[model samples]
Target: MRSDYKELDNEKIYLVTGAAGFIGFHLSKRLLDEGCHVIGIDNLNDYYDVNLKKARLEIINKYDKFKFFKIDLQDKEFLEEIFKEHKIDIVVNLAAQAGVRYSITNPDVYIQSNIVGFLNILEVCRHYKVEHLVYASSSSVYGMNEVMPFSVHHNVDHPISLYAATKKSNELMAHTYSHLYNLPTTGLRFFTVYGPWGRPDMALFLFTDAIMNDKPIKVFNHGKMKRDFTYIDDIVEGIVRLLNNPPKENKEWDKIKADPGTSSAPYKIYNIGNNKPVELMEYIQTIEKHLGKEAKKEYLPLQDGDVPMTYADVDDLIDDVGFKPDTSINEGISKFVEWYKEYYEV
Candidate 1:
């Protein structure tokens, strides 16, 4: 036997939706780094900043292992064409209409993208017999819950916003597919993810921009809001670790005493977060301290579709994958500031 039997190339043929977005961009880059063939698809939507999305794609396309697809998942015909072309060993569904407050004004877009679009992906995956399906779920699903650290095991039946409801619906819909088809699905319930290449709409990015430009950044809930501010690198690490480890049949799973985290079929849900909540104001101060600039402030009541605080229980993440988001907000925010100054030529 050859001694080189180990470290055989996995050679996974992967499809990544929303490959131009923040998390999608990071994940795709990591997969490309691992010598995996990655097919990246995105509509290049003008939600926040189109240039930023394009910039992310530029980095990904530099790798000979990456292929780019500029298409929307909502286009059933186009999406189906892609499925037929690629073997698609695995899929990471990251495409969706994001933002809580925006959902109130453009509810139809949320339905079209998050719900109808998700169905298209699920149907295609079922048809292709894809190996593993990983999709993004949101911490917003913890809406109106009195619990301190939101657990995947808790009942997520109550969602305050249309956005949160749609994400929660994805989990339920994914579970149904896993049950009926043995599809082996994993849903990542992401908390407040922040760091370099973050979305312009996210608080940290917006605050950094506003502070640099001497513009006022809105402080929601009078700055009383707290978040489980996970760093981007940590989130990416957790995802990559779970990519090769799809959920298997939970033999110990009890039907009589059902657990929301697992099912009789090959389906699982886990929270990916820092497991530590940070005060919103304190987070801002970290940014300010890094940038050497104070932000013009606008204190406001909590907006619709938003919660006062969100903390994630990541015990399962650590116990199962030996994973924990260990990046500190200070280090994370400082890195962001450094990137911002260089990107903007400030």
Candidate 2:
């Protein structure tokens, strides 16, 4: 399906919050490479390692068309200043206090960054007349659902963690703006994303780091967890395809049935996942295969705010964008390990 907005042009400015983040950095770099003007904003918080975030910024800074802003989304005044200065055509919000477990203790940060910060973004978009707003949602929103493949069409009323709840709230908030102000919005529910320059809190990085240091890795959920680990490049591709294609009001949307994915407003949701679920044990084995070393595992029960499995139903993504995440775990792991070894000089 063609996008309702005009075709993506190099002259148009794209505002990408969390540009120093894992997904944000990659997406910004890709746009800069395509000769697009990008206004990148990131707080560079010490959520993980600030140095890594700075390193990603260094790489993106080389592009002449890319400009970086050291501002937080919570800073509404600064965000407004940016909007006034740059005629941003599109806004992709990837900045959030991520991590389900982290939200257990650091709930305030999540509220401030994800909820309050998102409100600021929406208000700015509404006033500025931005063409499209695409933000990151999570598979954790499917909490307590036992379905085989989690679909956007499924009701996600039960969110287990504060982080998931905040993401679900983002979808609702986007819908409200779309309904009331005619702001085009799309929320992408990304599965387990992993690749080079991935977040350290994620499984792929943690497992690889511990194994290389000869430390026993904590195997959560008694090593029975399953995840639809989507590669970074594939996730970026999906976002790029949908950047111009803002959601339109579903003419056939039924208020009585109330499909959670679509709305009468210009709002839509999609799950961008590999669509292939892999066992946690098998995922670890793949890392071991690439590193040529076995990891000492300590089996533990499931931690708080974690689900047993996550399998995404990307039918909407494929139907709308004509693409699906196809990168295999082996290839993705190998690439990450290669980068890990070189980055740390291991």
Using lDDT as the measure, the top candidate is 2
- The sequence of per-residue lDDT tens digits that candidate 1 reaches over residues 172-263 is 99999999988989999999988888899999989988887789999999999999999999998888877777788889999988999999
lDDT of 2 by residue, 114-144 (tens): 9999999999999999999999999999999
lDDT of 1 at 231: 94
Off by over 4 Å in 1: 1-9
Q: Which ten residues in a row have the lowest lDDT in candidate 2?
A: 1-10
- Count of clashing pairs, candidate 1: 0
Candidate 1: the clashing residue pairs are none
Candidate 2 local distance difference test against the native: 0.94
After superposition, which runs of candidate 2 have C-alpha atoms over 4 Å from their true positions? 1-8
Candidate 2, residue 175: Cα displacement in angstroms equals: 0.4
Evaluate residue 287 in candidate 2 and report its C-alpha lDDT on the 0 to 100 scale.
97
